[model samples]
Target: MQLKNILFTSLLVSALTYSAKAQFVGDALTFSQENNGGTARFKGLGNAKTALGGDISSITGNPAGLGFFRQSDISVTANYLNANNKGTYFGTNTTKNKGRVGIENAGVVFYFPTNEGYHGWQNFNVGISYENTNTFTNNVRYEGVNPNNTIVQRYSDLMENPQNGAWGDKLFKTVLVEESLDPKNGYFPVVGEAVNKNQVSDILTTGYNSRTALAFGANYNNKLYIGGNIGFTAFRYDTSQQFSEGGWTKNRAEILAKNPNSTIADPTHDDYKYVEANYELLDDYSQRTEGSGIDFKIGAIYKPTTDWNIGATITSPTWLTVDDYTSSYIRVDYYDKETDAKPFITKEVLTDPTEDSYRLITPWKFSVGLSKFFSRGLLSADVEYVDYSTNKLRTIGGSNRSREKAWDQDMKDSYKAVVNVRVGGEILLTNTVSARAGFNYFGNPYKNADNKQYSGSLGLGFKLSQNVYMDLAVVHLVNDYKVSPYAIDENHWKSQSPVADIKHQRTNAVLTLGAKF
Candidate 1:
């Protein structure tokens, strides 16, 4: 295939294509994004631990905060998530829900205090942590009548493009589409015109990204805290889509009437004999991806006054090696009425599972934060920046340099840098009770699209005993975006194609149990 055609197909058909090595701009973005998932206290605080210290979440948020530990500590967190997606396609709306429960995080910090008056260093701390940074569990379903085009038209268009080669041969083999009698006309759907086909699709995705880090921190003269961590990340993503279209109305007579100058094939041929009134097509595609990466982060927090803390951190790009596996199949069912006894015929085609591997470098991230301490409460805020355009992909064993370069260029052309903001506060409601609230805003990274995400959270902390405590947090997130099932060149279909607008919402409940020694 031509490089341009390959790029176009990879981007437009990311969800539908059966290509095993289809790493595109979307995959780059998915791996770069992070979620505020950690201990309930930190999650409730909008993950604003950059400036505030004394929490295990700091191992991932800002290792420098580990210096605030006055004693050895250990904590474990559990989470429950519920995702809801509302999709609108071709004037029809559908809602789907998915739920999952898992362990969110666990960590331990060991504090070593220096001898009093031993230089300016007050203490050194070491920490080990495991955190689930992102979850991909979701489900979406939408159906509607399409009046303009069908996926068959897209296949027909592809058949005309020489660069696409014989990829559409399977469509012809399955009898879903047929080659035109005239070579110049290319291919056409056997079921006829592209209009008024009832289309429905159900998609399900499941996976997660997690990080394990070994961190170290130090406190200097009770004012300056510095820390760094070496982090390893694990990633897995799986998605499956089942699409079906029906309501076909076509007959040999209708074809002859529409094209007066056309030549009709044999009357008994499958293409000419069947009325196609009850034709239906089913397309199923699924993909699984697994990968691992490594990154480094260093940060510092300075306290110039007893009430004010300033913090900053810089994280190096993550170097990821990914492997993808994909498989797909198509099925067509129709009935022939010309026989003495009408019979239903089914034709199916399947592709062998394929696998590919590659490497990706995510963009660097920088963040700064400020926190203010109060007699009964504290408030903190943070700002982060990342340039999505900097993401790059490399083919394994240096095998497809041109393709890799094209993907890299596409990332730069389709993405941009954006700033994220987070704010949160904790109030001591009673001697043994605390209340926390937070808000987070993730900026849009697309160059020509709006896909920002927002999250809000509320939490409570209980001092069950002097040595043990419990924290509970609830978070709500919302994101809205659009997806195209298929794409056609403007020359083939001048009008806009059908698209699905999806509004996704997620609710998370987290509980953390901790003890200090």
Candidate 2:
């Protein structure tokens, strides 16, 4: 029993639902799911600023933190980021790494102290800030040998299936086929048997998710602070993939060169010693997305005393409008000893410059935090939850409404809610210097545990002057996941062929400068 034949007998449930809908894969990964980008201080402390309010970043996490301010302040942050991906495929392993720099955060806050006549109000503040929330810059490459079967078997299966029209189907119409072997059924991949084939795939991605926010807040006496913010968000994600497979070719120039006179009909190569191998469908595919949206944030901070604090925040789903473009091409190679055909070459554009527009409703989020204040610093922790399944996809101008509806249902069926936790603390080592550390845990969005992310951070702050400060921070993250290059309903190794186990490591260094007036 051939491997491809066995695949047909056992189609896993996950494979069955892989792409019966509209999108192919990794569609939802484009969203900013863990938007924690902020000032060096915030990131250094695991971004757990909910109840330990007072910094510029706190304005977005919990606007009420803005009300805790008593001075006009401005700050800017820059970050250097590096990512590495290690992949293990059928007995082979590979690794790739990339690095870049960007402005992580910049913002200004204005404060207004209430007059003495205002007994309950302590201060009012307004803020404007920008943050790079998510990054998608990574390079991953994986390769391995597959003696079981080849991609050509997929094309053969497509033709053998009754659903894909008759012998004169679209795929059958291609010139790369041997119809004589099965005139009634379909065509064969090669004139002879195939063996010793291997597959290599590469995936490259780059882009970002950013947000600009305008916020307002006020302090009530010495106990409560409340605020709201309006945020504008934008995202861009670009990715490309290249996959190649090679193996059996009697006329494979290598073999043909040795046996210059051997015909395609020659099976055992009585005249030739070794024939060069051949591969089909060396292909490249690319996709890009540009989008923008608006979202709202409201939050409150309660301080019963100077020693204890509690905070809560709510964020509405972002309504994003996006434009997607994709292109792809494939090259197939073959050689025929008969009909005087030599190294047949043909290229086809599988996808043109296709454009698509759609709306995405991101999930709503809720967060809560607690803090304990000391004479020198504070310790804080936060917990957040968002139902990723609520992420929805709608049709454009009612185009393909029914089909999109089904896709949305699939999104809900495949996704679930996630819980993220963060903890951090700052300690004033001296009157002019401070130290900070934090840890964050992000639950996996997938049903399996292989995709979760964990981050740890360390930082330092220097009080340059009474009104000037500088902060430095470093964060490290690790992710373990699986990437599938392609998943047809039935690639005998459909369960394994395109799937690669990937281990990813990311590091970031941020420096922030701030001024208080």
**TM values, all candidates:** 0.92, 0.84
Q: Judged by TM-score, which candidate is best?
A: 1
Clashes of 1: 0
Q: Candidate 1 at residue 301, lDDT? A: 99
Q: Tell me the spans in candidate 1 whose CA falls farther than 4 Å from its real position.
A: 1-22, 180-185, 192-194, 253-265, 336-343
| Pairs in clash, predicted candidate 1 | none
The TM-score of predicted model 2 comes to 0.84
* lDDT, model 1, position 138: 90
Query: How well does candidate 1 score on lDDT at residue 119?
Result: 64
Give lDDT tens digits, candidate 1, residues 185-218: 5676656555688888888889999999999999
lDDT of 2 by residue, 101-169 (tens): 999999999999988555799898999999999998988888887665565545554455564443224
